[model samples]
Target: MPMPQEYQLASQHYESFLTAAREALHLTTRNQTYTCVQATLLVFRHRLTAEQILMFADTLPAVLRAIFTSGWSIDDFKPEFGDEGDWKAEVKAVRVDHNFSNDETPARVAAVLRQHVDLPRFEKVLQQIGPDALRFWGFEASARI
Candidate 1:
């Protein structure tokens, strides 16, 4: 079979995602957006089992899939989903000087991400993973964005 479009246009797709994320976060540079996005991905990743993470990653675009799973360790302790403040703090902790993630970061990133994925499959995976997963990604159980 021919190479997948995601693989063929990997750089283009990643740039598009970074552009959208930068705009959504109102960030001045792609580097700031990258730090925030990576940190946010890790915050969510810490709550999922390996199997669930794989299921979710399968729905992402090529570059995003790599970002979501990079440097993951299944042996790490999975933290419980806590308050939004703590989550935001965690997002800001990565490359602390560069990360500019705020309380709305996850929601903004989620909005941008929805535009790049198979929404139905993405939502299905979120639903299967349970309510906390849905909320972590700034999605509501019955709401479609």
Candidate 2:
């Protein structure tokens, strides 16, 4: 009957996430943090099947769900999960000139995200998505968060 809390407070939640991400990444601005977070999410998105991507997005907070799905092209080629270095390269390539993502971006973003989401549910989805997804988010396949 009424609007959801997530919708009502979407801006607050998103700003809080950006604040946390900026602190975790040691960045000075939300724009920089946004680019880094977006890039990291895109790198992971490119590795998932369309269905898996939707499943993963479902576990995210409202604003993050929006971020995850924004600009997605179902027809785009899915990339294989290469080494961690490859992941970082892809993340940093998002907006090459403005991107500030680094080697620790994915793991750091994961840490911040874990604090904001329902960890058990998130981990469960990651598990369902398979081990590579777990590793992409900086969790060991057998590890429980």
Candidate 3:
């Protein structure tokens, strides 16, 4: 039997995420990329409103959408979105097993996400999120991509 279209699309989406993440981090394995992607998703989600987070997840591919919501807790409080350094520290603290580097890992992960996701739709979703959105993606507030 032929492969189902949904299965093929899901596979393609996952591969695209891994490929971009691996290339960004110069990593050898999708597992390593997955760690970074997962960590980034968690860290970023913590900073967004529940509604914004869901909107962002809706914009992602199937595998990424799953990763975004994996292990999420609805009753959890949204952390304060402080400066970039504070956010990076939180990411490191959240994924100590992955030993997330201060800035590079988040930047690489965000770059990978940008590479795979729909940019304009993402921008629209975060339009109300202000500079937090930009900084989370390792962008300067005024910087436009």
Candidate 4:
């Protein structure tokens, strides 16, 4: 496909995420990876404050950024999730039609997301959400770098 000149970089970023998410989740289709990325982003996005969410979205590649913020409802701020299970459950619920086999999907998705985004910028965004953000994204102290 011939991406527009402006879309080149954005496509590259999305492709990077697609490749990472697909391999991480052991999914076959780019569509499944896309769904996983969207689901994962929604899981994290709802937990963030409005300010943090905007800032984080701005830092993402264009296509992924839109996916991150898509279908968001700010009418009710989501409560802080307790652990990986809580967040994973929400993600699965978002994509209920798909079966997420590995119990570790959330952590694996987070690991792939970290690989794709600009870590320093993401770390700054994470700071706004606090330590729970780090744990929620499955990033440890070492992964912060």
Best by lDDT: 2
Model 3 pairs in collision: none
lDDT per residue for candidate 4 within 28-136, as digits (tens), equals 9987777666777787887777887888887777888888887778853677646677777777777678645355677777888788778878877776667778787
- Give per-residue CA lDDT, model 2, range 1-145, as digits (tens): 8999978998898889889999999999888999999998888998888899999999998989999999899875476778788888888889999998888898899889988888889989999988888988878986653
Clash count of each predicted structure:
0, 0, 0, 0
Assess candidate 2 and give its TM-score to the true structure: 0.93
Off by over 4 Å in 2: 143-145
Give candidate 3's error at residue 98 in angstroms: 3.9
Candidate with more favorable, higher TM-score: 2 or 3: 2
Ranking, lDDT, top scorer first = 2, 1, 3, 4
Write down the TM-score of every candidate. 0.91, 0.93, 0.82, 0.83
| Per-model root-mean-square deviation over C-alphas | 2.1, 1.7, 3.3, 3.7
- Residue by residue across 2-57, what tens digits does model 1's lDDT show? 99887999899999999999999999998889988898888888888988989999
Against the reference, the lDDT scores of all candidates come to 0.85, 0.88, 0.75, 0.75
Arrange candidates by TM-score, highest first: which order? 2, 1, 4, 3
User: Could you give me the TM-score of model 1 versus the true structure?
Assistant: 0.91
Off by over 4 Å in 4: 1-7, 99-101, 141-145
